[model samples]
Target: MLFFVALLVDGILAGSVYALVALAFVVVYRVSRVINFSLGEWVTFAARLVGTGTHALALPLAGALAFASAGMAALALAFNHVVLHRLIGHPPISLVMVTIGFGAVLQASTVLFFPAGSGAISLPVPSEPIEIGGLFLVPGKLVAAAIAGLGVLIVARVYRTRTGLALRAIADDPQAAMASGIDIDRHVVLTWSMAGVIAVVAGTLSAAVWGGGLSLVLVGLKVFPIVVVGGMDSVAGTVVGALLIGVLESEAAGYLNPVLGAGFSSLAPYLVLLGVLLVRPYGLFGTPGIERI
Candidate 1:
């Protein structure tokens, strides 16, 4: 019982990280229908910038975060506006492959520029752990969770407001939305900006939780499962899926390793994803089509 409780706590923390990343994935997809395989590279780029700014250049932590996020945000906006917008009606598969290629380029560029392979660097965020009833909790993880929750609320509320309602109208029908005098380019840019900020937030919180580096990109990758388990469009589903994967993976590593071996522990989420795909197809909260033939 104690073990399960501990697992739940740890899972919630880890799941917060996953939720943030999943949120990033969903944001871009919701607005532009881009999968953005390059998101991991964006995370790696932000981590490298943060480490360099704070450690190498002797900048203050707040300044470093601002610089890193700004750099990533600009790059994301450029990538979306210049490169992707040109391919607006291209085959989805082609766009996805292009993003994957772009990610490789960014990763290679980071290796050349930083010369420090994906080594871990301490985050500027506070890292002291808090204890409750013998369970140790990292404050950084809780902070990340709060930020993710706040982001969802803000976005939802914005959608409820006049401007947000306008965006939704665009989402519902881009042609009509444009004909209705909505600035389509501005909307697309806003979507990219939102996605970029979300990605950086995930990278920063992850740097605090697991340390900063290229390996932190895996935080984004692990979130792919969360998006799969939850519907890509469902923010609540992402949060719940993140928590479930976090606790289950941690518990497996802690207890099942003795019997199932260590190598299999990390694959738990993928297994869950495969099972979910087989059973639910669209995920826990994904849409069910009402086809009329």
Candidate 2:
């Protein structure tokens, strides 16, 4: 029982990270209706920036983080104004393929810039573990979880504001929003910028926990199951899904891994995604689509 409790706690904390990343996906989708497959590349790019700022440039922790945030935000805005902006009114398939190509470009760029043999980027957090009632937790993980929770709160609060309402209107119907004088381009750019910030924060915190590496891009892929299970359009659902997936993954790692061999935890989220799709095709909070032939 105690062991299970520990697993649960760990999973919740880890899930918080996924929740943050998933929120980025939800935010972009809500506004632009684009899947933004290159999101992982953005995250990888931010992580690399953080690593370079700290390790190579020798910037202070706070400065490195700020630099990463600004850099990512700028990159996102540029991608929107330069690439995506030109492709407006094109087929959704074209945009998706462009994002995929962008991700490949980012991956190749990272390899070119950082080259092979780049070591782990060290975070400023202490190496000590925190003990709470006989349970030990990594300080970095705890801090990251706290940050992720705060991010969720901030985003939730934003949804109540006028700007959020405008974004929501655009999401509901772009044509209607444009008719109402809501600048679709402006809102899309703003949404992309926000997505950039979220990706940076999540990527940096994840790097703090696991260290910066090329593989950090995979974090974006992990968020897919999270948002899908929670309902792509529902922020509340995203939070719940993240927590559920996190705990289940933790449990699988702690108890099932030894018996089932390693890697079960990694596969747990997808299994849940399949189950959710089969049972609730629209997701827990997603509105069911109706079509008449």
Candidate 3:
């Protein structure tokens, strides 16, 4: 029971970082219906920017994270205004391809420019662990989880606001929303902007947790299952999905890793994703779309 409890907490901590990543996906998807396949690149980019701040600008970790967050948000907004806007009328497939190309370009740019991030990154946090009710927790992970929880809370609260409803309106049907004078373009920009900020939070916390590098971009791929399981369009479902995957992944790593050989834990999330798809095509919380045709 104690072991189970510990694993549960660990999973929650890990899932917290993933939740932010999934939220980044959900935010943009809600308004644009575009997957932003390259979204993970921004996570890697932001993590790299932190290294830039610490080395070039001599900023501390907190300052570096702050700088990276602002920079990423600005970059996302600019990308929306310049690139996405230009491709507004293109086919969805074309947009997805563009995102794939953009990801490649961003990856290349990151390698050429942010050399510090080519390899694994290590963030220094206190070595001491926090013990509660016979369970020990890492301080860094606890902090990251707290921050992630707050981000989730804020997002949930936002849905109740006027602007948030307008954003949802765009998500329901961009064309109809536009006809209703909801200013689809502005909402799209806002969603992307939020995604950028969410990326930084996810990336930075991930670095502080396991580490950071170009590999962190795989975190993007990992989010597919999360959003699918949690309901790609449902914020509350995202939280539940992250928690479920986190717990399962952690448990697999701890128990199955030794029995099934190493790396089995890594495959756990995808297995859950497959199961979810089989059981509920629309996801545990995702809304079912009605086809006019």
Model 2's TM-score against the true structure:
0.94
Worst 10 residues of 1 by lDDT: 117-126
lDDT of 3 by residue, 135-207 (tens): 9888889988888899888887887799999998888777788888898777787888788888877887777
**In model 3, which regions exceed 4 Å deviation?**
117-125
Q: Which candidate number has the best lDDT?
A: 2
Instruction: Kindly report which residue stretches of model 2 are placed more than 4 angstroms away from their true locations once superposed.
Output: 115-123
Cα-based TM-score, every candidate: 0.89, 0.94, 0.92
Alpha carbon lDDT of residue 110, candidate 1? 83
Candidate 2 lDDT over residue span 117-139, tens digit each: 33255555787998898799988
Error of 3 at 72 (Å): 1.1
Better of 1 and 3 by TM-score: 3
- Scored against the true structure, residue 109 in model 3 reaches a CA lDDT of 88
Candidate 1 is scored at a TM of 0.89
lDDT of 1 at 176: 91
